[model samples]
Target: MRRILLGAAMAAMLAAGGVAPAFAQGNPFQPLVYVNDSVVTRYELDQRMRFLQILRAPDGDRASAEQALIDDRLRLFAARQMGIAASDAQIDAGLAEFAGRANMDVEEFTRALAQAGVEQQTFRDFIAAGVVWRELVRQRLVPQVQVSDAELDQEMQRVIETPRITHVALSELIIPAPPGQEAQAMRLAESLVQSVRSEADFAAAARQHSATPSAENGGRLPWAPLENLPPSLRPIILSMQNGQISQPLTVEGAVVLFYLRDSRGTLRPGAKEQVLDYVRFRLASTAEANRIAALSDTCADLFVHARNLPPEQIQRQTLSQGQIPTAEAIRLAVLDDNESTIVSQGGSAEILMLCKRQSALLAGNAQEAPVPVTAEGEEGAAPDPDALPDREQMRGQIFSRKVGQAADNYLAELRANAIIRRP
Candidate 1:
């Protein structure tokens, strides 16, 4: 029954020119290998290799293609044995989502693939295999994973002890556009971006036209860890050479620009270590997110708003700079304690607030440490360990690691026990 369905699928693919003209002279349906009772066809291998090549995968060669197909077969077989299958709707959604990554719809993506001699079924099968295998893994292995508080504490300690590897120094210029002058602001920013050539030039422009408080310091910012910048801005900052100006970036009611003064490895000797305490509030609507942000001045204040909500929707954590996710780290970096920013992601909005920032030297380090200060420059208090936020983030990380290891072990076991043959 499976062979019959496979043959029909391959026949449709062949009719649609799944195999390139170069392979048309031979029987593309010939079996090259088998996983248990499942066959991996020559036509399938060719399609996969072509697809990988279109994706610019480094290992798009024949050996990689064959192994990938064999693994796909094993995954599908395992899924079937576990009575797990991807529905047509799920597969279609996956295809659409995958295509969206390349900024194309599924039909357009398929057309592009066809132009490169890969069939639509090749893409569909690939997504379906992944979807089914993920479901299988979740059901079979995810339930057994656990991360204890001890592990979380150790991970937190390790993150704090790890020194940041890279930091960037930057200057900024922000041009405020009162309700009606956005275009004028952007044009002015663009002109400055083109004219600015050196740190001195940037400083002059920043001191003259920038609205940010740093303008008084010639818009110069203290050296910041690369991870501390917004995820979207990090790559752009890294790509700039020293003394290069950035293209104008539009922010709410303003146009902003940055000048890269320097990027360096490690901090200058005796730099104070920075730690963050922040809260994340995930809400279904921007209005709700705004309301919560307005109502809360401290991380603890958010608990009132979260009382009726799911525990997962609101999180407060104290973490070293390296422990925060890049995107959140970027947002938190710019926020003053008790100030919040609403970020929209995937049909929901997150209100991220910085509750406190503490700067301290590692214990026993020879360099004298500066007194820890909050975002407002007041002496900061020690974070209460008992009041630490839920450990869901750390728990999720440990769960992912365990699930990945389990998946690899499970696949290996399946491969060892299965009857795999190459012709």
Candidate 2:
């Protein structure tokens, strides 16, 4: 009951960013592994582990948890190298964001963390890494990434023409969207992703305590009509399984959760497989894709009203994903409704923004049909479900194949340039 109530408060906070006074908490000192200059103490790892438990990791992947932490450290190191730190204010905001996703009061969330045997800072460290990582990538790596107007148009064409599917109940946990307290939410959401990857017990996790009402039925939200879900979620669902979950994204006031169920459509031949990673902000079912679209439109409306405000009075807003959308993205991307503001990298829910240069590797779209292939000697295999992305996400599917290519290229360069000591 407490967990449920705290979750409820967290959701409310996500909609409105406000918290109580901080109480004196105990000192934190547990240490685990040291990543270069940084140390992931047992205390930190324990909190991380707790969060992962919430994510519902698979048993096979549980042992590899350390790798995820290491990757986070690597990203942290990069963020630092790029001088991108998630500021003090950002940390507070992130904590608030977490509480919001959980749907609790900040103070309530603080207490919940305490009850969970997690320190408040547990969320801080987790969220800070993501903040810094994204900032660093946008600064150092994003420069090398690019999306052509033609490509955007092509994606738009696909979104307009494709008639794929709806609801896909994934066998995973739903990551939440950004609220002022988004840090906690992201960690919760990301940890769920990691947990599902490790333990492969998503439904169990959902049943135990998913904040969504669907938790009552084990995180099983009924199949959303294809037209009802946001384009972002819809496309991502296309490539997932009947039990695959979505990555988190902020829709309206609450974080929307997803578990891919099943898809229905006549997959085309020779078409690229539609691979989607449904990214949703942690919010509620009432918050739909159209709501996000309406929010984006609202932000534009706010911008029109911004003509009268003093420069200092203007909100120092950045695109939530660190880039402006193309005309196609504007049409397809979910924007904040209240102010018509582009979701900012600093996070959303404010008025006014300066649209600077957009990043190419931010959010995107992709499409592929399952292709069954076998050895040259054998008959060409029919497309396999296991190899395909969730088909339920359908037309809005955007897989950053390029970013992956970039990451791979980056790693290759690192291996080529590094000096290794093998004992």
Best by TM-score: 1
On a 0 to 1 TM-score scale, where does candidate 2 land against the true structure?
A: 0.40
Q: Which stretches of candidate 1 lie over 4 Å from their true place?
A: 1-25, 166-390
> What are the per-residue Cα lDDT tens digits for candidate 2 across 73-189?
777666666677889887777777766766665797676555545577766777787677656655666677766655554555454345455333343333344446454554465
Give the Å error, residue 7, model 2.
4.1
User: Each model's TM-score, in the order given?
Assistant: 0.48, 0.40
Off by over 4 Å in 2: 1-34, 55-64, 153-161, 166-423
Which residue pairs clash within candidate 1? none
Please count the clashing residue pairs in each candidate, in the order shown.
0, 108
Best by lDDT: 1
